[model samples]
Target: MASSATTGNPMPPSLSMPPSQFARLQPHAYLRAHLSPPSSDQPSVRANGRATSQFRVTSVNTGSLTHANGSAVVRIGDTTAVCGVRAELLHTSDISSWGVSQAPSKQNPTNTNEAKDSKSEDEDDQGQIQDLNLLVPNLSLSTGCAPGLTPGAPPSALAQSLSHQILSLLHTTNLVRADDLRIWYQPPNFDSEEFHNPGEGMEVDTEQSGGPEREIKAFWVLYIDIMILSMAGNAFDAAWASVLAALRDTKLPNAWWDDDNETILCSDDFAEAHRLTLRGLPIASSFCCFEGDAAAGWRANVIPDAEEQKKKKGSQQKWILADPDGYEEGLTQERACVVVDKENGKTIIVKMEKHGGWNVDSDDLRKLVDVSSQRWDDLKQALEQC
Candidate 1:
């Protein structure tokens, strides 16, 4: 005791901190401690009581809205999204950019080769859905889902960016077929002799009275509106899952052009309605890379030489978290999302987006893709049930 006193070493009073308090005060340390067990005998787990590679439970329900053509609600963990698809008619005549005539006549016949080449060019130009803005996707995050979000205000940058991402994915995937949206009209064949020699050799305009002409008078424009009722994390995945489910459940009424009324009309019969044919199902999985360093975060404020401590650590640890919650999202800056689809007993990668960190390499990406495939199957099964 005398030697300890001389060395100025004194025993401090016993102290204890609650788990919730510790987590609130030192979130980075809390997560790191949970991920790293004190001994090898103990198993490492996440703060949410999940494994490193485990994903949240997903639920999908369709046809929830009576008025909408299609509707679905999807929940992933705490995140919930509701999607409604409303179809409106858009007349081709109203489109100023569409210069091509819908009906071709015998006298002013269109060149077959030129028409074929034009069709090819249009296909190469990424289809008419983009040109005509047929599919409109609106994602709203201002539903009081999370803190710091004000309702009824203009859309934030995050919401707009997510909306654009959804729209781009819809276009790139070619999920919706154009043929289903067309309202075609077969004009009466006026090529008969009675019509040609009507009223004592009156001049007949072949262009106006085209023979066996089929024209697209109008198109069904689908407006996909998605609302995030509750947001925990991974909002994109939830919103997209809702969209897929809603589109699958959507059934457009049979519509045709009315020549006498000079307008479009839809059948009231439910049997005549048809569902949109979507391409292969694509699912996205997101992962965040948590750098396993406690001192590099808030401790840097107290520890002036945190950089030196990080250097001395000799390569900081990293933990890849799958389907991170809101708390984990704030702790991690690096994120990667992999979109995958399965066809013909094979997994196909649709899209990959990675940013905010470079620790995730090709091998990590391949693993993420595998995870996405599993997620795709899970979502597919859920959608099939609806």
Candidate 2:
């Protein structure tokens, strides 16, 4: 008979699990054990060693990419995002021609007449269809950004969802004005003597001659693209920050209609460029809910009943954590993101999103808002410095 050691009995090794599995199993406990301070007097810390309700250090850099009209790179803790803006000339006539045509003038008419009216309506509708997409936004996430993302494949659901959210915010917040993008056309100077004998070696000096009433012939379209370089957590916040920085740094060049070429001409002079007028700086903050024993310390502070607490000690306890990372995020059951813009000395909640099954109390929500307001101030100052 072989000895016990040589019997080939497989024994479960001490710490024989993958790092990901280790992170998944009792994630909160792992954080509290490794990240929190040994002293009981100190509060429990997150995986990144940040106190509860505190965000990680954030940084931003603007106008870094020369190819893009505007560009910015934002880093919040481990999450990083880059945003770029490209400007393209779009004719106003084309956009206005896309609107829906008016209904037929006559409700009831002969078949031939109705057919004629339908054809006319079709033509009018085609002429009236307006292109409402003035600002286009897209987000890209690839394999290197995170673990599950694949390379060169279709964008994941998370990327598509983030893109939609950004589009919604840009449209609803009124961040960019329509008039700022308009390019006015300087009409020809028919009164000038140069127009009398145009074929006889006479050239029309359009730049020097005072023309008729000017009208908007075209507008500049801004295409905003965001790429996620790294995603630890809170991608929405990082993406929004990058967009704000890039847009703030954008400058549109002076554009004019060229009647001779039948195209819009943009001035090469840098001095002729104009900056966008932003309504206000908007910032976002995100939070996650940590339930069970992970929140015992917080629950103790909130509920000051020794006997009641003892009775419910075995019950689940809940706490809110700000700026959670990937490991903590996996264990969290609920999340909330709030966007605030300061306007005229008052804080406005421009957008708010909540997900997951956990229900937050009114008091807890109020606390989250206060934290978000503070975070907005921090982010706004950082952006200004950039």
lDDT of each: 0.84, 0.77
Error of 1 at 342 (Å): 0.7
Cα lDDT tens digits for candidate 1, 267-338: 999999999877789888889999886445566678798768767877888888999999899899889998
**Candidate 2: tens digits of C-alpha lDDT, residues 1-386:** 87657988876577677655766776667665654458868776766667889898999999999998899999998899999999888785676442233222321222434365444543432232223577889998846888977667787889999999888788656677665776766577888776787667677665456445456677678899999899998888899899999999999998888889988888899999998877578787889887656554456568788437556555555658898877778777688888788877688888877887444667787788889888988998899999
Model 1: weakest 10-residue lDDT segment is 101-110
Regions more than 4 Å wrong, model 2: 1-25, 32-42, 96-131, 186-214, 293-314
lDDT of 1 at 192: 55
Cα displacement (Å) at residue 81, model 1: 0.5
lDDT of 2: 0.77
